[model samples]
Target: MYIIFIGTGWFSYVFSLVNLDIYFSKNHWDRYTNFAELSLHILCAIGIYIGRFLRFNSWSLVTQPKHFLSILPGELIGKFPLVVIVLTIAIIAGLYALCKPLVAKSSLYRE
Candidate 1:
């Protein structure tokens, strides 16, 4: 249950990063893309933490929005959320560093 949610979050976060890169590069703002990508990663990390700890998934924004909204304010400002976001970002960044070398060396990015 929890594992599934975390897995989904991880996939969504990584894909969002790739999409963000494509978008920024296409727009010719490559210089600013890294900052934007990191920002989004931090936000997604917080979102994932909220879902994991508060039991509020993304659809809650459409279905049970009030429940989701009610908790968001406090959660976003809390020390716990900060810790979770920082830790999540660290993990994601480390994974990216590990994978980036392999990805760059591969022919996949040659296009």
Candidate 2:
């Protein structure tokens, strides 16, 4: 139980950053891209929580779409989910901010 929970948390955090890094490299910075990335992070965070707490897998979502959709609103409306989602976003944003400087520095060095 401990390992599964902790692993889910760590994997979600790193995967979000990797998604951002991939987008940053592929797409030039733009307002729309920024918004898209943020939304993606939020959704991923929420999905991670659902997977961790509800014990649902990707296949579960596909196999039981109605069941999956039904639970999402209940989860989203509650305080616990809201707090977890917000914290996840904040963590991802902070990580991006910290890494941005390093990426910029390295880009300069590459030139």
Candidate 3:
């Protein structure tokens, strides 16, 4: 279930990025759009850590938001969580770079 959920997140994140490139940047990514995309990747990486290790789900964000937010800084303070987030960010950004062209090139279907 968690895998499925994360897959959804990845798909949504990718489409959001493509849309940003298309609409926000007028088909070309600007510095601000790139910044926003990278920031979101970092946030999602942190979210993955929180959900996996801390066992907080989407409901926790609504029901126990204060607790959730409170734990994050302390939890992410150490080297381990920092390493996880950084590595996750690298994976996400790296794959996105590799896949963006494939996504854009999917116009291979017959007209």
Tens digit of per-residue lDDT, candidate 1, span 1-111: 999997666655555566667777898989997798677667767777888988887788999888778878987897887888899988878776665455545554442
Candidate 3 lDDT tens digits, 65-92: 8998898789888989888889999998
State the weakest 10-residue window (summed lDDT) of model 3. 102-111
- In model 1, pairs of residues that clash are none
lDDT of 3 at 106: 58
State the number of backbone clashes in model 3: 0
TM-score ranking, high to low: 3, 1, 2
Q: Candidate 3: where are CA atoms >4 Å away? A: 1-9, 27-29, 108-111
lDDT of 1 at 56: 84
Candidate 2 structure quality by residue, lDDT tens digits, 23-82: 666776554656766887688778778888777898987899999889877867888878
Superposition error at 23 for model 1 (Å): 4.8
Give residue 46's lDDT in candidate 1 (0 to 100). Answer: 79
RMSD of 1: 3.7
Q: Top lDDT: which candidate number?
A: 3
Worst 10 residues of 2 by lDDT: 102-111
